[model samples]
Target: MTITLYNTATRSKQPLEPIEDGKVSMYVCGPTVYDRAHIGNARAVVVFDMLYRLLRHEYGAESVTYVRNFTDVDDKINARAAEEGRPISEITEETTQWFLDDMAAIGALEPNEMPRATAYVPHMVKMIEGLIEKGHAYAAEGHVLFKVRSYADYGKLSGRSVDDMIAGARVEVAPYKEDPMDFVLWKPSDADTPGWDSPWGRGRPGWHIECSAMAYELLGERFDIHGGGNDLTFPHHENEIAQSKCAGHDFANIWMHNEMLQVEGKKMSKSLGNFFTVRDLLDQGVPGEVIRFVMLSTHYRKPMDWTEQKRVEAEKTLVGWYWMTEDAATGEVPAALIDALRSDLNVSKALMEMHLMAKNGDAAGLLSSMTLLGFPAVNQNLSPSLLEKVQRTNAAPDMLDSNSDLQLFQKKLESLRADALVSKDFSALDDLKGKLGAAGVEVRMTKEGVTLSPGPFFAIENLEVLK
Candidate 1:
């Protein structure tokens, strides 16, 4: 299947044709290791991870080259170290591992190569010297700045003109800068700070230079796809393009950027009192799988809003799916399922297809599709006894007292629901439902019947009165 992706560079959906027939290469801008990855960051993590999986699906697994960099040498890391009275290496190393653990919890695949910025300092220096030689950059007071206007297409990725950018006034105007729009490529570092000796002087590479250098070093001059959050489309990606193209490298052919995430219909901000980290949600007992499901519920190109309602729905759906596929062996993922994912990571559509498969009693198909979507798969078909034991563990403990007790509660609730429909007086029904809800049992009412799926807080003893 020819995988089609939405390219921010072209502003169009284009089919991916790898430079090498069977090999695929992709570079995603990874995190700067200073703090825990927030939900906003998780969106980009899952987005590129989905693309990485899809690329491997279309191209053979071994033929794919995925590189995600670790920005270990950022000012934020330095500041965090100084503020906490710890070594900068300790901060970067700890936060980098935290990033990996959290993303892995949410089902992100590790990239084929994870190169740290500190390791690529020499490569960055070489690239900067070339940019200087090509007249795309210049040295000013021990600092190297990219000549933005020197490359006519500097703002092409962000679709902003240089004149407009200058008029807008976001550029950092420094006495060392020849133009307000000139961005730093290399900045001087003192003895106290992390420093590398270079042609310019003792200095470190700029933020934008890290990805450009790492991508070139790992994936070569040109690669298949480059991805990150929409926030990076501007100065970050735009500068990377200018410098890479100016250095005479082909660079990434397809530029893909996922839109930013939101919380409850608003931009997640600490000032707004809605900021949350991935670890926070996990600590609150939301399964990592559920978080991954909620992320996929919305299309990658659209802004995903994380809500409590979505979390509950995801939990309910996943529990049902896991139970349904308990004894099923792995089957081939449906072709239609793959088509939905291939069409620009249309995850919501793929989710719909998986639901249809489940409803049709295609347990094997359902399991396969879930795994393809990055959900965990059961390595072996679970035995009936083991499945029941697992279900009891997740269900409210009080309700699973005995077989007779289980039947009694289900029969009682089913009777109450039936009466509530006919009497049109759901006062009793509502009360029982509320009681069940309190015990961590979700009450789903359909035209055909009432279904009770135990939630994380379920308790069986609460239903003793029904007996």
Candidate 2:
């Protein structure tokens, strides 16, 4: 099946037809480097990373070019620099490094190009000059403003009318702007703020222009995908669309936006005392894979509610899948999972199918499915002594006489199963089942008898003898 993504601009699922055969040029808006990345920010990174992985797996890895940018020259960084009494470049560099480190810890692949706004000042200036020459923008009071009325399709992407946007805008109408809805292309800077020599004066590019410049410079005017958080749908992405399209470039063909991440069922906020950074969660011993799984559990377009219980559940789920291939002598992954992932990156459904495979003791199928998910299985070396122990244990009758330690271990396993059954904890039950299988204790539930063997395969009639 051809991969289909729900485009926010059209509000429909459209088949992804690459601009070039087997090639995809995708760009995701990256973080403004002034503070540690919060979980909400990380969600966008993880979501896009999954898309990139799926695209690479389906197509050839060499065919995909992923560009995620860093807004190293922004008001936030300037404010942070002033507060610390440091150069804005220093602040941007420090925060950008932290952002990269945090994302790397979460297992996100680095983009093919990580262009910074600071590096693309000349591009921004040239674009602003083009807009001015075309009568799409004009300079007033040392600030360059885009003429919103000049672009008839200004609000097409966002579905916001100029009147409504003007009414909702927080900034008081500046005297320089002909229309309140008109946004800044560049703004003048004071002596203390970071600035570049521009035709409009020594000033920095506006927030929206940075992305337009970077995307156009890296991926040309048109690309396969431009993605980011749903919050950017408004003035941020809207402005980008206008700026790029008005410059006589096709801009991005497909726009994708991932939904927000909530904490304890509400929007994460410092005032609500539920704010969390990616670093904060990692410090609490949450595994990076577990965090990635929880973030991807929900569909990209849907909100993800993160809680301690949810995180623990994600970890348990990952451990179950990992344990299946831990002892396998072979490393071949199943093709079925790859087929599912190719069908629009349907990970939630794919994971459910994986659980079903585990339930039926399909180890090869399970391993194959995980490989398709971009997590390859590793070969775990069994020590000579451990292998000997396994062989000796298997040789005994029902592991009863294998080792003196077997009795205590069986008792512990039985207690866990009992507690799991009593509490109706299916997750705990499944985890215990996997643990027992990994340890060479096979359990069968039947009306005839509870037969315990030392391997996955055993005669059904053996239950009668145990009874």
Candidate 3:
């Protein structure tokens, strides 16, 4: 089956025919690494992750190359470092790790290449020098600016004219720029800021140029797909087009943009008090799988509303599915689900298909589809005892009760663990652990023995059958 995507550049849905047979390349704008990744940031990461998974499924996993860049050197990071009285490197390194941890928690696969802007400074300088040599860029007052007028299709991607952009867009009106539409390739940095020695002086690459130079160095001038949030459609992506094209590169073949995320039908803002980091939700006991599901419940191209209602519903649905498929080995993904995903990456429709599978008791199919959807069973690779300990800690209570019913359930879990150790098959043990989590009971399986206790969300009614 052919994969199709809604290309923001051409304004149409088109088949994803890779430029090279049996090979696919992708580049997505990554986080700035100034702070923790917000839910909005996770949406873009997960959206591209889904696409990467689908591409790897269509074309062999080894055939696909995905690159997501990190803007480690930026004004935001500089300000954060100054405010905290920390080294710029310290701030970037910590924040970059936070972003990776947060995204991994939400089940986003690490891209093949994560280029930090600072690492590619020399490449950026070389690209800027090439642009200057080609008359596409000019240096003024120790700053290098791309001549927007030099590229004829400057506003083609965002569907805006240069005149319209100058009038409507909040462009920087620097006296050094020949035109208001012209954007910086490199800018002089003060002694206090992170800077690199270049022909223009000790400076840093501008925001837009960092991506272009990094993408060129990693994925080359032409790649199959380029993606980011729609908010970047205008100046960020448009400038990338002007700079990359004027330097005689075809750049990205297809441009994909996921819609922005909102919280409870309103724009998420710190002022509005709805702003949330991915870590925020995690700390509130929202599982990473639940977050990923809620994000994909809506089509990628549509605005996603992260409401409490959606979160609760997604959690319930995932719990139910996890329980139903606990003992089933992953089977082949259903054709219908694949079809849904293939059609412009219609994740909503694909999820609906999974619901149908769950309705019909297609446990193996459901598990397989869920895995493809990035919801693999919890800790399937861990030892049965280790897996039980993890589920126990999820909503663990400080105290454990030695009631008769709890004792009997603990004995049964021990028996299951004993059989699993010999057979080296954990399906039955995993199934029981699923029930424990579903019933809100903390399950502890250690070298000494198994223990049962009521957890934070414990419901005795759900655990009575185990007694």
Candidate 4:
């Protein structure tokens, strides 16, 4: 199982040949714990998640190492804590849990290791000392700055020259900076801010240094892959590469960056009233599976547009797919589906392969492929009682549950079906179906039984006549 990934640094797709046979290592820049992660943040997560699955599949699960760092120590976190008048630890801890829960809801697997920045403060201080000793960094006014020009190939990762970057970037005009391109390795923190006692002073690390140090400490001097959203490509990744390479570490072998997200063909922004978090979508009755489906509908390298139409189509598609595979047991993952994913994580093409399997009514094959893509044949969002029943029985009949009134009406419908058989008249059954359909219930009549499922527009008010 050969895998090819688009290396952003090289500007071309390359076959993955790990430094060690039968072993692979990768790192992805994780989220800063401040608030609920928006949809844009989720794109990088889903992208890397697919890659992780592919790597684990190719090189046995035990052989692949994946690390995603948490930027727990940040100015945004401090501000959030100040605004809430609570400790910084409380904010980071709560938000970290929220991030994990939301990502899990969308079916993203947890990384092999998640290193928080604050926990690795000693390593960061050590790395900073190395950079200063190597003349790649200097300290002044209780702040340490990376001398950007000290690394001649500073912009190699981003494919920009220093002059061009300085011209384009809004570089700070601090008197402490040796040059406008110099970035902070360490900055002084106020008494109330989150800081660690360092040789320079009591201060926290800059955002870029946190990732560089953590990746080096966790993944070692060099690793196979490094990933993040394209928005981080410029200053964040560029600065990281400069710091790592200057410290004489080879760093990552390949760079992978997923493009940002859009909503309704426009840049998603709160000012535009188009910005939404994953929880917001879930709260609005959009299933997490729907969010994952819409995300994979487009290529990771391309901007993903989240429209209501896409959401509706995704929901319909999943409903149909889950139905097709309901009775199917696990089967072999189609060779073609794996090939599609191996080709630069082309999930859009992989999903198309899944559609072909479904079209041929190969439910077992489709179910197997869906499992590889992290979509379960069964929805995990059912109620507690329904979920227990599903786990015990390995089936969620219609995946529906409701109040006694609705259950009583369903029993009434079942009795009507039984009598209609004897009377040789289905008019009563037909009428009941119509009324239920009007109330936004999907009615399925089978020789075995009648099942009622509520849809997106289900309304209790419309089910009154059945009373």
Candidate 5:
């Protein structure tokens, strides 16, 4: 089945047909390097990371080219530099590194290309010059602004009229603007501000222009998909669409946006005393995989209510899945789960199906299925030392034996069986039955019929009666 994505531009789930056969070019808006990325910001990263993983899994890894850009030369970064009394470059570098570290800790894969606005200044200048030459943009005073009226399709992406944008924009209307709707393509930098000498002036590119330039330079004019948080749907992405289309390029074919993340039913903010960084979540003992599971529990386009209970629930669910597959003697996952993932990355549905498979005693099928969902069953490769530690912590006195190998294997198997029960996998019961029977164990199928015991291994006494 072909993969379908919810395109923000069309407001529909469209089939993801690549421009070039077997290859997909995707760009996700990256963080502005001024402060640590909060959990809201991390949601976008994780959402896109999942998309990237899904795409790579469906297509070959080499077929996907992912680009996420850093807005290093933004007003926010400049303000941060001033606040800290440091050079803007230094501040940008420091903050960018911190952002990378935070994202990595949460298991986000590095993009194929990570471009910084500071490194793409020349490209931005060329694009601005092209816009000016095409009469799509103009230079006024020490600033250059894109003429909103010039692009009749300005509101196509954002659905916001130029008049509405101008009225709502909180920034003071500069006297040099030809129209209030005209957004800055370039602006003059003062002696202390970071700037690059261009045909317009010694100033930096505007926030919107930087993305347009970087995207064009890296992915060409018409790419497959451009993605980011829903908050960027307005002026930012709208401006990019206008600038790129007017620059005589087709630009992106699909625009995908993930919804905002809220904390405890409220918008995550410092004033609410609920603002959280990914680091904060980690420091609070939230597992990285748990964070990922929680983020993916809801569809990407739906706003996620991140509460502590939700996180705890996600962890419990993940631990259960791990336990089910970890116990199979053959250690094979079910194929049904893998098939579910191939259908549209329906992770929630896949998980539900896994429960059904477990109930049906499909151990191999369950293991195979969960593996396709990127949840591999635990195996013997767990470090011996770690296993020893686990044994020391959780082993019952009766479970200890002088033989290290037997003790470790038995303990691991028992833990796996316990986990399977917790995950509601009844297939594990049969495995336990077989193992106990082979070890000369006798099982009485009593009125309750829920327990097993060791008896004469080779004796087949009252087999029919036991059933």
Candidate 6:
């Protein structure tokens, strides 16, 4: 099977031709681990995870190497540690586990290698030294900075001239630097900050250099794909390419960047009140499967918007799918699904095919397709235990108990719905639905039946009015 991806470096969709046939290498930028991963971070993780699954499917699982690095050492981590009055190690350790747990909850497969930035400090220092030797970098005042002008093709990835970049970008202005366009390779760490002894001084590696070093050490000089959010395409990735190429390393061949995410058509920010972490949503009784479904509904190249309506629809759809495949036998995956994914990770199209399969009552085919798409379907051949775990996690918190009053309300709603269908009037049914929603009971009505489950804000006392 051939896989074509839109390469950020080349600005075109190119077929993935690995340097070594049948062997694919992928590296995606992981989290900084200073706090819980927000929705935007989860988007990048899920996007690359979809690609990882596709690569494993096309190339044998053993033939693929996926590396995602953790930025254990950063200014943000230090600031958090200082604010909490805790050790840096403790902060990094706790937040790192938080990242792993949250990502796992969303069905993201772990990369083959998760190198820590601190673990690869020596490699970063060595690379910096080589850049200095090659005249691409220089040391001043115990700091090493990459000379942006030293590389002629500095802005090729971003497609901007030096003057334009300097004018448009947020280039740090330091008195020790030779030029404003130059980026830091190594910076001096103070006594209170984390530092490693290097040729320049007791300093730490810069953020951009850490990835370049880790990718080279793990995936070698050349690799197939390098991925991250599009926000990094500017100074971060541009700097990585300049230093890596100057050191005579081929580096990554294909660059894939997923678009940023928004919440309800607005940028997610703490000030906007829509900003939330993955843990926040999960804690609020939103199923991980539902979150993944909403994310994959949009194309990776396009911006994804998270809204309450999408969440409700996703939960309803998944409930129906689970019911359909409950008694299904394992079957072959649909070829059309693979075709959609192969065409530049067209997950939206693949989701459409699954919807069609569900519509046609192809239970076995739907089950297999859902499993391949990372849903927790019953994979009798592989992991039967997954179904049980998913069922437990997907259950809403404070699920409605089938008591006499609740049952009466359910029956009344069913009768009202039937009456409304026959009389062609829905005001009464709509009012009852609104009441149930206010009580935090999710009312799902299908041709077969109606189901009421507790939502995140479920309050049993609120049901007294219904009685």
**lDDT (10s digit) by residue, model 3, range 110-188:** 9999989888999989999999999999999999999988888888998988898778758778999899878889999
lDDT of 6: 0.85
Total colliding residue pairs, candidate 3: 0
lDDT of 4 by residue, 1-467 (tens): 67889999999999999988889999999999999999999989988998998898888899999999999998899999999999999999999999999998787999999999999999999999999999999999999999999998888888899998778768777998889889899999888998889999899999999999999998899999999999999899999999999999999999999988999999999999999998897777677777887888789999988888677656655665676576788898989989999999999888777755654557888888878888855754432332343355433223222344457777989998899989999998889888887665668878888777554334344465666
lDDT of each: 0.83, 0.76, 0.84, 0.84, 0.73, 0.85
lDDT of 5 at 419: 73
Please tell me which predicted candidate would have the highest TM-score against the true structure: 1
- The reply for model 1, stretches above 4 Å from the true place, is 378-390, 393-467
Q: What local lDDT does model 5 show for residue 338?
A: 50
Maximum-lDDT candidate: 6
Of the two candidates 1 and 6, the one with more favorable TM-score, higher being better, is: 1
Candidate 6, superposed: residue stretches over 4 Å from native: 378-467
Tell me how many residue pairs clash in candidate 4: 0
- How high is each candidate's TM-score? 0.83, 0.80, 0.82, 0.82, 0.77, 0.82
Show where candidate 3 strays beyond 4 Å.
Answer: 381-467
lDDT of 1 by residue, 56-139 (tens): 887778999999999999888888888999999999989999999999988899999999999999999999999999899999
Find the 10 residues in a row with the least total lDDT in model 4.
Answer: 393-402
> Model 2 clash pairs?
333-368, 334-368
Cα error, residue 389 of model 5, in Å, equals 12
Candidate 1 TM-score versus the reference: 0.83
Q: Return the TM-score for candidate 6, rounded to 2 decimals.
A: 0.82
Give residue 49's error in model 6 in angstroms: 0.4
Q: Is candidate 2 or candidate 6 better by TM-score?
A: 6
Residues 211-240 of candidate 2: C-alpha lDDT, one tens digit per residue: 999999889978999999999998799999
